[model samples]
Target chain A: MLPTSKSCILCETEARKIYAAIFGGEIPLAVLNRFVVATQRLNANVPPAETDAYYRALLACDDLEALEVAARYTRKLPLLTRKFRLMAYLAETVPETQDFFINDRSNLLAGLWAAFTGGLRTAVKLPAGLWLLRRCAHV
Target chain B: MSELIIVGSGAAGAAAALALADLGLRPLLLDVGHTDPGAGPRVEGNLYDYRRRHDTFGLYIGEDLHGLSDVLTGETGIAKLNAPNAAFVVQDAARLSPVEASGFDAIQSFALGGLGNAWGAGLYRFVDADLAGFPLRAADLAPYFDRLTGEVGISGAGDDLTPFFGATAGLQPPLRLSYNADRFYRSYAHRRAAFLAQGIQVGRPRLGVLSQPRDGRPGCDYSNTEFWQDAPYLYTPAVTLRKLIAAGQIDYRPGVLVRSWTETAAGVVVDATDAATGAALRFEGRTLLLAAGAIGTSKIVLRSFRDYDTALGLLENPAVQIPFVLPASIGRRLDAQAFGLTQLNLVWESPDHGRLQGSLLELTSPMRAEFFMRFPLAARANLALVRSLLPAMLLMQLFYPGAAQPPAQLSLREDGTLRIRGHENAISVRELAPLLGLMRSAGLWTAPMLIFKPATGHAIHYAGTLPMTESPARYQCDPTGKLAGAEHVYIADSASFTALPAKNMSFGMMANAMRIAEAAARR
Candidate 1:
């Protein structure tokens, strides 16, 4: 289940794209590498078949839409618990993500606006995302 | 040969050692003494700014992602034990002193400072009402409380809690409160009469943290790193132990796991095993003080007697945590100069429930990731919601009197394992509703879903394992802390507490230990 160099590169690219889609910016390469290494170490003990299947589905995504669909599918997979952990790490470590979540909400109006926009985006994207993920990952 | 031998270097042991040293006697202190490895990087500024500036999750969440596992596995409760640098506080406890618990989640520390290394530093003296079943009264421990306040500085204001916590001689100014806590305190003050009608009182928490630099330790920097790193100003038993050793007042031996003791005609022989090696060791002294905490002391007492059938009663505070938000503080800038410790103390005297104690803490120190993953929403939505609510959140940790909890039993098995069968004595919604109503009257908003009741023993204030009585039984000690069946041996910790109160018991433990040691010195 250890990640090879090629697989590590693919994982980094996929993580970068998924993080950008969710957070609306590019995650620093160093922070992204740390997340990838943490993910690999956390999931090292999973059954190889489960890991292989996840990578297969992840590797099949050739475009941003397919990648986003695959990301949503992996979100529901118990084997891919590292996905959420990675997102949390990015939200904590990356400056843009931190600003989007915490630094920008310095006043009541800003906090309300952030919560409203964030909640609205979730409400609009969840249904369509779920439908596409189910068809894309075939899980 | 040492005149006295004390097992464990925790609060009670440290206090006993210091008290004995004052009497021109040096005691030998034995402990496992696990210490922080001090390998993690330190943060310089406020936690929020540090997080925004660096990618140093290892400092708080642990390099191996220790704190993240709890979030991923959906474990909820106190997060201090999981912080990276504080892990050593609980290290080697499970493997060294294994416990077989049924419904109890037992937490013990073998560190040099014991559990005080990670304590919230809430220091309050038990009043007469709180000492209901004890053989002694508040007056007996009052002198020692004042003396401890001088030795280790306390920070608090004399307010509504003065009658409950009692007055100390030298208390430093209380630390500054965060925005949410300040608002709650002011609102309660404005509606004081209404709250007092319901037998509720609020005041600043008396903490064992320095408000001004003293004895070479700096005042609280208010960097909100209380959970992530050790502050020299904060009082831990190890701090006292180090001073005692530096002055050559006591012989402090770390890496010694005390097992059992035997009292011979000559003296008391303590049998222990070196933690580094499997080899057994023995030491003899004129007096033996069992200050190895409630659980540790109980285990040694049971094993020494080879008694497997007798079940000692265990007491723990049943606690409920209520998370609320101040609507006015929602979008306000985060308070950059706020301490992470408890901001206010709540004491309520219910006609039906006796006395209940609670602490108000602003949720500013612990990493948001610890709460983010627990939210039911997707990753992005959960993060956004947590951040939006971050500046306004406050947690009220309410504790019920341990005397009221259903009695849990601690017994020794033939295989050398301690078994704890805990019975649930949780506070129901009905029991908490009145308090919630009072909070709402003060403009603090909470929902039923946000109320969390962790499993028993999470309160971590264990006591009454081998209680003191007017007439001592086989497992009981006398009011003088003399074990009934042993010679020149004393129970100097909470193991001899006749009753457990809702307030923090560490201060009482130290005072009683000093009392016992003072009496032991005469003999």
Candidate 2:
């Protein structure tokens, strides 16, 4: 009955491998390897420690929960870095896992949250549902 | 005694002072000079991040998009210091006298740089046709144009607009045009011959901004922070005034509001009130230069004429905003570039009719999102879907140069305040159809709520109150910018403009102020 039923199951398998590798440290490290590759495409000058912390947080939480945690970590990054990390994380994760959180409601809420938080520049980080809860903190 | 005394510390005032000082004459300048303290919260590397974040969240979240336009243009001063009707930081309703209005309201900024702080910095020059009934010809004002252009570091290229806008020697390389503007120029360039035959000209705008680093200020970093905060790197009057003051070339006095002036045997006596204290102040100078904007200058002149109140012509251009979407550029990704006040300018002229100039400014940032809020209530509910249309939006402001300018009258009240009366010309879609048609011909199309009605004084290119005339008995000022009744007083601001064309008036105002000041200095 979920909206994510139409998405690719390959995304679920890949997301599991990445999640297991992050915490269990016994998987192929394929998901982690892709993440490191994605960081190369980022335009922002993100610090090594910040990147380390971002990955560590995902290991501690579920896929969507990790997204929220990563969004908070983005406060310390430059606007460019924040956007790249959020979008990259969403792109790398399994499509089925991605759809679990990224419904129409979450998309709209993320845009509103980003716009309210900063403006277009701040809203740049809202491609996924990661940045939604920051609006609540303001309230 | 100082040889010259200047009123207002904004663009015209700053230009007048610098022009006088260049001749080694340091004029005494007076202004309310409301310096709003606290550069709102700064993000690392991005100074304006905090301010934008706080304002966007508070104003736009769940709010009717219809109100966002008012918030940007009406609620707060869009420019850093030019708060409407503000006599500095605080809008003391009691201290300020209200001007009765009808269709539109004229906003006044009592800050140091005057309205120059909030100016678009579209530094286009007026040719002979543009300066049609003025005392000085285009040739007479050409050198001052060169001097000011060189001093301000205007960013423009000599293009098809050169013959009309005139050629200046020192202009910084023009900024890279936004995707939409660039695409439009290419589209126009491909059909350049046909467009030229139709009496329509498209070219890059001559901006009062630096394309490359000059002086100590850095070149524009393409931060898209121009509208919201002070990009000091851009050419604000404060940048020019600061340098002049540091060099000891100008004496700037703040918190002083000039109420009236009287000509005396030895010099001109200026009566003023200190905004900081409720105390009377007096200053005397051999010459008085009034650059206190069009409305402010007229008010001072009318108040000085205690024996009688007079009606002055308030010439203003009737303006309309034409927002269109380029089909090719829709839904494209946004880029970080030097977003200036205007990217390209479109001018249409006919021998039988007259001239209309459209200053094209493409909305690239989330500022584009604000326009979508004007969409229907049902459409705006899906913010994510609504945000996609942002990259495609382009707003072209069409200004009618030779329209019938309804006059604003300045009269002295018994309460010792000057009152202004005027009506703004209405914007009719019927009148703007031809302009819209031309845009459509160029592959640009509009949707509903695209063309919005601009309030009177919304264009903000106000002038012709105390216009220069051969018959001093008829007009307030003569060719030398001297007020008819006052011997030592001169109106150097836009108040002395006989006609205001569709082009941005800040450059013309600053150049004219310098012209007047130079004449007075020699006299």
Candidate 3:
């Protein structure tokens, strides 16, 4: 059985492969790990109900852009557009690892989403959205 | 004559009237009741006495009084308050209130000011993050919010100048913080330094109360007395219409009860009966706004469900109130933000006391919500035995998201009065412990929170119905707040909300409402 046709709720793509190879995908691992760590920090203060969603989004998204885009579908339905914008600044603010490949698969992961968003928009995002979405959870 | 006939004279009705008046549209406004400002029930005689024929509280409890031809036939009207029998039927109905299977709560207020009249005036804005996913931003909503604030005048501070403002913030100047509120923030700020450290805003409470007269409203007295009926600074819709009537811009048709409507290509011919005469009049308007509160508006929409398939969805106040005991203050402390909801747990330090912790983090001294708590009394004594301690109950409301499914049938009897009933997922004590703890630690619980249990009493923040969908087929209204089947008709109140956030949703909706109106007007 073709494991059920699914479309990324954001991108609205029906199992369409993302052109991560050409347009680029995934955040640097250091930043991805940083988001993972920050997501942990976010949980310490907020309600567990809210924390779990935030943590899950950070773990799944490969980059900040994808994560922020994922937030467009998360249950809490938080607005993370600014957080997505902030990721660029955040990346520029921090030092990067020399061995990092910007499009590394290790950096790629699934992120959270607002329930109402559609297929492709929810899926096939870059680290820019993911990085911001992860940071917004700390908010 | 432009032939504008406004339906209710509450916040939205009055605001619309005033806004229209400013726009040079002097349409006739009709209310079922009339009153004089600053008059202690001594102002005037009923200009149009629908009294004998009108349902006494038709608008008050219209959503629940399902089968009543008595009021119209002069068989029944207002119920006596003091007499146990006056509202006894309603009480009994409360006993048999339906579970959430029906998917909505049926609440209506007939008080003169409409729902906004009874509002606690806790004004706050939707966070920028609240608006992040959507295409619209603060700049897009600037004009409408500016006009609303210029006309209505809200009072607020923190969310104001923080570049963090979404289009929904700064609707009006913010309200002043209460004594208890000032104390609560000072304590709670220190407890949660980690979150507050990230430049995350702890709100400066805002409210619809005016600090100074703008558009003729008086500054708040801080008395908070209108807890029941009429008082200044209450900011109920009644006050606006009542004042506008004095200005000769709006007229009183206080007891006019809407019977039904016939859908027409142009619009609807709303059949209504005069409360005093029992006579029928079919009023016409090119435009109509149902700014009636959640249940009332939804009830009317449900009444007209045949015209629109998506009419029945109610952005339910899947209201949850969590009560928690503050590790710091425990029981003796009480506090909140401007609009009766302390949405933020602000932590700050007191000038006098020096403690190790810099920011006084709160969400510590949670409340004993009357509804959530089960203070086990000596077996056999119902909660009534110790009703004096009702104020002791607390609840920090967790404004959850969910919509009440629209009722399949919303029918009104010959008298133009109807009744509806509904509830939510009632969690067990253990399940509610954390929520209760949250409230207690946060100190946002209300007195009703202490009684046997409260169910959505003040979960008044409305939304989750009439959402904007990418597919026009899936939505009742677009993100712009226009109902799908009908053009030139839109929802300006909380009913336009599809996703209910934690903050007060009115500011957000009004901003959208104004934008929709502006767009519609341009068209």
Candidate 4:
């Protein structure tokens, strides 16, 4: 079995605390606040089943597998929303994540950017530059 | 005439080949370069699919259970902490030596880079004191070390270990230390005066990993895949060999194992059998260099001698693993930063004993449960509790001088097979008390020490089988690695190490090989 947040050394402290709170039957403040904001953004048009699946997957993902699932499903957000590439960076750098996340050249490049930009916060800029450079090189 | 024949494509052989190629000499590098493409996490599919297909932790639990059991039962003969995860590296077993002897575990890789595929990347230079009696002094070896560090791209800090662990300059910036290691470093620094009084000096260890991207290879991304995956970016022997091959300097031949060689008037005739097809082959070389590890080289030398059944000594430092726990990080969420290899080195002098060094390594990776299982835990403890102890755990490997004990014996039997027999040099519990006390004095909670004599040839640091001396003797080589009786043959591996100090011998072995090859090319 994959290590849970409680046992995994690679899990972020905030993430572990959030997991512990959720497991203790207390709604995590960040997650609950995010959900409420997400609900407000949705204007009460919450797809109940989709919302439920998302929350269930998030809660069930106490390890890297859970983190990957959360990253995967959230990857297809609207154009206005941030893509799941940030989570991909997390999956690559976080020791809890699978080796596949860290093995490839693209992920390795992303990981290099993450290490420079202080963990995925500056992901879009680096990858965008890379994409432009790659296109220009081909041209 | 054929220029030079390098038997093994390991660190020593690769270093010699690259150096010789630079000197305008052609080297025919032959190895059983098994095309066992790394089975790392396949980058195909999505993250979820990748995690399911390549559950490294689960795979470890299933496949490595027996290896772990053998370690605990004292069947493997090496410390569980130091044993390589052979499955991860895709090592081909059939091409290696099939020596199965009790109290001895001499592992050899016939792959492209030989056993260097499994090296921990801990590169160190032997100081003048370490090479006191050797024919080649540290002063003579200093230039080659500088060249090697520049060539391989070592990552290290010029800290307290600079004096003892030479080769400080031209190093790439080191990867950030893990949280566990940082805390230990801080504690060690805070008590530096106290530690000095007790004969302990702590500093960052020199590693052969690139801190930043260099020469088309990406820097260490700190993915903690260092143990299992080669990551391609790390400075393995094959990486240098690839560069040499690309430069059209190396006449690289793969899949042929150099079984034995005979010295003739014109040149030496090297015989080998194809690893894949089992076809016998022969190659003639003006000078034959044996860098196929100490044991592997000794085997070929014994086979070539044929006339005499001689037993040679193989030297290795006695090592012990001491587990320490940090009171501060216990039961807390800890982040594994930096690479998962040995990060810091603690070296000190004992009044009674000479120079003793300890390589401090953080055991924080979840994939490292194979080692944590060695702790005599309560049978009922859940996996979570077991893992909770990991963040605070640190491994301190003590490497005492390699010269203390009698060397392991390598002999040729009547059937012309090489056999090695060596007993583990025991360290009593009483002798470990002071070392434990020293750790406690430094505010680190020391656990019960698990002491086991690493089986003969277990540490993989054994050398000096065909040692270099001022004058030629039976089973001894000249300063430039020339065999005593055989003029055309030369030794280039750890087999020619005149003295095996308690330091990692890879860097020294490679430097000496280049030194030997350079001298040979002059002739």
Strongest candidate by lDDT: 1
Over the stretch A18-108, how does candidate 4's per-residue lDDT look in tens digits?
Answer: 3332122333343333323222223223345543443343344333222332232344211101112112112222234333222222232
Per-residue accuracy of model 1 over B1-523 as CA lDDT, tens digit each: 5789999888999999989988889899999999999998788877778877876667766667665655444444458888888788878787888999877778888998889999998889878988898999999998889888888899999999999999856999998888788888999999999999999999999999998999889999899888888888789888889889999999988889998988888778889999879689888899999999999999999999989998999999888889887777767666656788799999989765689899998777877665664444455665666777667788899888886667689999988789999976567866777788989888788888778887888889899988899999888999989999998889999999988888889999999999999988888
Ranking by DockQ: 1, 2, 4, 3
DockQ of each: 0.33, 0.02, 0.01, 0.02
lDDT of 1 at A6: 50
Clashing pairs in 1: A107-B331, A108-B331
Worst 10 residues of 3 chain B by lDDT: B352-361
What is the C-alpha lDDT profile of model 3 across B32-127, one tens digit per residue? 543323312211122012122232222221222221222212222222221111222223222212212232334344445654544555544455
Ranking by lDDT: 1, 4, 2, 3
Winner of 2 and 3 under DockQ: 2
Complex DockQ, candidate 2:
0.02
Give the alpha carbon lDDT tens digit for every residue of B1-523 in model 2. 6689999877889889889988999899988877645334222233123323332321111122221223322232232233221223333322653565445456676776766666678888878888888877888778888999888888888888887778857888888888778888888888778778778898888888778888876777766666555665568677778788889898888878888888889789999998768589999999999988787788788777763456676777777777787765543444345483588998888443377778888664333334322432211122322343445557788887634456666566657555666665555667655556666777788854557766656677778888898777644788889888778888899889888887777888888889999989988
Candidate 2 off by > 4 Å:
A1-139, B43-97, B338-340, B350-353, B365-369, B377-385, B416-418
For residue B481, give model 3's deviation from the true position in Å: 4.0
Q: State in Å the error of residue B200, model 2.
A: 1.1
For model 3, report the TM-score of its A chain: 0.32
Q: Among all windows of ten consecutive residues in candidate 2 chain B, which has the lowest summed lDDT?
A: B58-67
Q: Looking at model 2, what is the TM-score of chain A?
A: 0.29
Instruction: Compute the lDDT of residue B351 as modeled in candidate 2.
Output: 46
Deviation (Å) of B340 in candidate 4 = 0.6
lDDT of 4 by residue, B198-257 (tens): 777889888888889988888887765565445655788888888898998988888787
